[model samples]
Target: MTGKIVWAAWHPRHGFEIPHFYDGAVAFADIDDAVRLVRTLNADDKTNNRNGWRAVKTILVRAP
Candidate 1:
């Protein structure tokens, strides 16, 4: 079935500007799971002094 895919996008950034980082988008079947991961990742980044952003995104996909 074609449906919306949930993804957790983590933005790793420097304090001043957007810093480039080799990041991978993680897909989740549920929005709750994606949000959970985003929170966990952003919290970890904060604790490690890695200032960045994280969000839950959705994309429509076609099922073959």
Candidate 2:
């Protein structure tokens, strides 16, 4: 069974944005988990003052 692939972006002083051009992303078997991660990252960034951003998107890939 194949799992779903999610894409997210992290930027300075940004919350969430399009995954395009972003090489960094987080993946999860469940969409809920992916969302949770985004929220977690956002909250973590707030305290760390790293000025980070986090976003999530689902991507479709064809099997080779």
Candidate 3:
């Protein structure tokens, strides 16, 4: 089985655009676990600061 590539966008403090690609199976056994894993792996500088933009909200899913 091959993992898919997931794309996500992030808006930083300087209004800069940031995009990320995550390759993995989104079909986790549990939604909570999937979310947690995504959150951890997706952890970035922009999402760290309270003043900066929060975590990724819109994720572009790609099928492989």
Q: All candidates: CA RMSD in angstroms?
A: 6.7, 7.3, 8.2
TM-score of candidate 3 relative to the true fold? 0.28
Per-candidate Cα lDDT values, in order, are: 0.53, 0.52, 0.40
Question: TM-score of model 1 relative to the true fold?
Answer: 0.47
- Residue range 1-64, candidate 3, lDDT tens digits: 4444332323344332433434422343344554554465447543443444333333344546
| Residue-by-residue lDDT tens digits, candidate 1, 1-64 | 5567665554555322223333444566776775665566567666322345555466647656
Task: After the best TM-score superposition of candidate 2, give how far the Cα of residue 27 lies from its true spot, in angstroms.
Answer: 1.0
Give the residue spans of candidate 3 off by over 4 A. 1-26, 44-64
Q: Could you tell me every candidate's TM-score relative to the true structure?
A: 0.47, 0.40, 0.28
Mark the regions of model 1 whose C-alpha exceeds 4 Å error after superposition: 1-3, 12-23, 47-51, 60-64
The most accurate candidate by lDDT is 1
Model 2: C-alpha RMSD to truth? 7.3
Better of 1 and 3 by TM-score: 1
The sequence of per-residue lDDT tens digits that candidate 2 reaches over residues 1-64 is 4645655444554444424434444455566675566666657556332445444465645556
Ranking of predictions according to TM-score: 1, 2, 3
